[model samples]
Target: MNARGYFWRTVQQQEVDYIEDADGIIKGYEIKWNPKLKLKAPKSFKEAYNTDVALINKDNFREFL
Candidate 1:
């Protein structure tokens, strides 16, 4: 089956770097270009949408990719 979905910057601008998906499954992603940089996800990200939210760092970015 084929699914379609999209993710956008919320009004709060949680600072999501990117999002990836193949079906209806929603995956929230945060990309940090800098290895030493720090990123944080907004609380509303998970509750606002019925999707999975994750923080993507240099260490585990492959999992999300």
Candidate 2:
């Protein structure tokens, strides 16, 4: 694989599912199986990395693909 690395992060109970190093771009994801549940953005990640995190769920998983 050409990806640089697969990363995981956690700050208390908040977390990122993974940060995929695709080529040179770092993509962050948080996944929820239940679309109806509320999803909170990982603010610490944005503050530390200056990157936005994407959410994946049953309702909108196709877009992530």
Best by lDDT: 2
Put down candidate 1 lDDT per residue, 1-65, tens digits, no spaces: 56444565777665455655556566777677566765576667667666666666778877755
Instruction: Give all TM-scores, in the order shown.
Output: 0.57, 0.70
Candidate 1, overall lDDT? 0.64
Error of 2 at 33 (Å): 1.0
- How many clashes (backbone atoms < 3 Å, residues ≥3 apart in a chain or on different chains) does model 2 have? 0
Pairing residues by index, what is the TM-score of model 1? 0.57
Candidate 2 — which pairs collide? none
Which consecutive 10 residues in model 2 have the weakest lDDT in total? 1-10
Model 1 poorest 10 in a row by lDDT: 15-24
* Residue pairs in clash, model 1: none
Model 1: residues with Cα > 4 Å off, grouped in runs? 1-7, 34-39
TM-score (C-alpha) between model 2 and the true structure? 0.70
